[model samples]
Target: MRDLVRQGWTITAEETAALSPYIRAHITRFGAYATDVPGIEPEAFDPALDEIDFTVLDLAA
Candidate 1:
């Protein structure tokens, strides 16, 4: 996630929700990593969904 952000992609809210559980768990147990991404605020994570709408910004466009 951080890698994508560093490369100029945007992780949408749905995508964040989809990944939130794993990301939160990882961050809690393994320490900071993906949460370091510019727009990935820890407060926004929600892991209660079965599906997500993933989108990315196309900087080339």
Candidate 2:
């Protein structure tokens, strides 16, 4: 998309309206949505994830 702009390729307002950031073609303007999430069983916890060190980090800017 950056290359297109560098090459002078331009998008009209209507064309831009048809496109979206990150996610595309999955948006619903108006609709009723429902899910039976309570009926689903949750995933079991993994004890192996506790072995990773979380305190070590290079947070300096």
Highest lDDT against the true fold, candidate: 2
Over 1-61, each residue of candidate 1 has an lDDT whose tens digit, in order, gives 8999999999998988776444443356755566457885557777865474444335435
lDDT of predicted model 2: 0.73
Residue 31's lDDT in candidate 1:
56
For candidate 1, the 10 contiguous residues with the lowest summed lDDT are 52-61
Question: Model 2: residues >4 Å from true position, as ranges?
Answer: 22-61
Report how far off residue 18 is in candidate 1 (Å). Answer: 0.9
How displaced is residue 52 in candidate 2, in Å? Answer: 34
Clashes in predicted model 2:
0
Tens digits of lDDT, candidate 2, 1-61? 6788899999677987887676446777566566756687878988777777756755632
